[model samples]
Target: MAARTVSFGIGFRVGGSLSLLALLAACSEPLDLDMRGLMNGGFNTADAARASTAPRPAADNRGVISYPNYQVAVARRGDTLAALAARVGLPADELARYNGVQSGDTLRAGEIIALPRRVSEPSPATGATTTGPIRPSSQIDITTLANDAIERSAPTPAAQRPTPQVGTEPIRHQVERGETAFTISRLYNVSVRSLSEWNSLDSNFSVREGQYLLIPVVTQAPAPREVAPIEPGRGSPTPQPPSASQPLPTETPAAAAATTQAATAAAAAAPPVANVGTQTAASASNAAMAFPVQGSIIREYSKGRNDGIDIAASVGTTVKAAASGQVAAITRNTDGINILVIRHPDNLLTVYTHVDNITVAKGDAVSRGQSIAKVADFEPARVHFEVRKGFDSVDPMTYLR
Candidate 1:
């Protein structure tokens, strides 16, 4: 009876262990929860199946968006002004100017670039139109756009008139040994006319050593003008000729003879005017000519070949007018280099090329040695200067002092 009880106990323990293992195996299986149907309301097999099969939109690589008025471009990594301009079909310089950035500057990744909605407005002076990728107006700062428009539309001041300013005082400078009016004007960064006017001296007056001269400070205030008093209800009457009764005042015979002799001597001492042909032949013979820029000549003019001389100069160097003249043309070349052509007395035209940041415009009257433009970056970094008589080019060295 005891042996039979032990066998039954071992069999019970083994069956219990097998039962526990089977329970654990059942618990390990996935629950297969109906999430979509439960969130909607209860378990609906059809709704859960539809939720799992729906399609979604793919991601975009351009990272750009289109709006009703304007489009925007998101800058990518390693982008430059030139690259952006080329991508958008706009000129690199124009693009830089529009964004108030330099053409050689780099653009930051993820930066917003403002583009024109439609075609850009044509430049009034050049009549050139811009074509490129468009940007929305909302992306650009309104104030910056307005300021740029104002600057482009504002009229340029006359070259002969100095820009006016208030509360300006005269600059006093003491004349040094061997300093002439030209040198003093240059030292003070002033025009010779301003120097003469401030000191009450004539244009031909010579500066003496140890003398103090007052240099006029340029101001925005317009110079005062003298207006004659008008008669009541009409302008001033023209002066009437003296009556015949007042015989023309006559000088003494001895004095008149001496004046006549002096006049004859003065006329004899003056140089004769050259004929048109002679003037053309000797066009490059002005002794008072000034150098446009202080630099060594890299390329000299050769007959039947090069028409101008190239002077080696550092970028951004100030370039002055070789002689006083009226600016006939201020334009850019195909490569966007600035060119200035001035028409001087005696039918002479001086050409300055490869320049940027020009100070004068067309029809401006510039003085000799006046700053006109700054040297621009070119392959060789030089200025091409030409002295021309109508269509004939001459050697600048023959005329430059």
Candidate 2:
């Protein structure tokens, strides 16, 4: 192939210079070079050389300044979108839509203000990795710019992640050969009635082989109130008017203690509610499941009484298991000829149906992102996930988090 050559206008203009500066900042992008270079030839050679030497982006690998065309950054604490737009030569409304923020909203520092016709970014994965090109408002000074725009003193993401709530503690008890639920209840100083309810088993107390159970010590719940019929001549007492300062009665110390204990036990015995996602053991595959794709959640789960939920994804997109699990059942429904089912360690089942091809076999264990299948049928295919306990379908949204 002949050597490629570029052309530029001899007389450079100021408008072309700033845009060229942005292009030079994002020289890695081919389209950026062609577009910005057309306007860049007139820039002062000295200034262009100076900018090339001092380049250090604070956002680990996020080169916000590289894509200068569409963005202006928040410089200091409390800078409004209007003010930032004035500096970057864009409308305040444009900035608002870029960051999904409002015009009157206060920016912290180092935020990007996406301007029109900004430089494009190379796909770094397969193409060039220009920092400046094609950045949106969300990617401005994208590193520190986005973070600093709110507060230099803002909490680090790890700090911002909500603290894990204190979930139910694992209760433990050894199984005695001859002991029944009655015997264990007496030994633990807990009521048999409470024990049956704590465990999801029937009240028959049919103890099984060598299973260790967690005994939750719960207080006896008060009997529900009942309405009694009165004789024809009897009358009910009149209700008293409410008074803000009136005090409430205090339960006896013994009753109060019992209530507290029962509450603690009940809390300990409860199971985590059903969710769209399921928890799994620590593994590389389990962690990889947090991201379904690079796009969005176009469809949702359980809109009706359906077996599973669907996630609309691009056709031919790679499908992954929700978490690490044993391959439970693989079936080709009459309608959906291509289907895959994985049973995670947590007993959660994720089904990838309507697939173009199945890469896994029935009973073949798979991992998250293991490329078990692909969406071959339509423009965007869906992966149907159904989490179950035994055969009971549970809501999956609760666990996706």
Alpha-carbon RMSD, candidate 2 = 34.5
Candidate 1 local distance difference test against the native = 0.57
Measured on C-alpha atoms, candidate 2 has an lDDT of 0.47
Please report the candidate that would top lDDT against the real structure: 1
Clash count for each candidate, listed in order shown: 7, 25
Q: Residue 328, candidate 1: how far off, in angstroms?
A: 0.3
Q: Candidate 1, 171: how far from true, in Å?
A: 61
Estimate, for each residue in 2-106, the C-alpha lDDT of model 2 and write its tens digit.
332222342346569888789778753222111222354632222221221111122212212323222224234567878766655567786576556678877
**Worst lDDT window (10 residues) for model 1?**
51-60
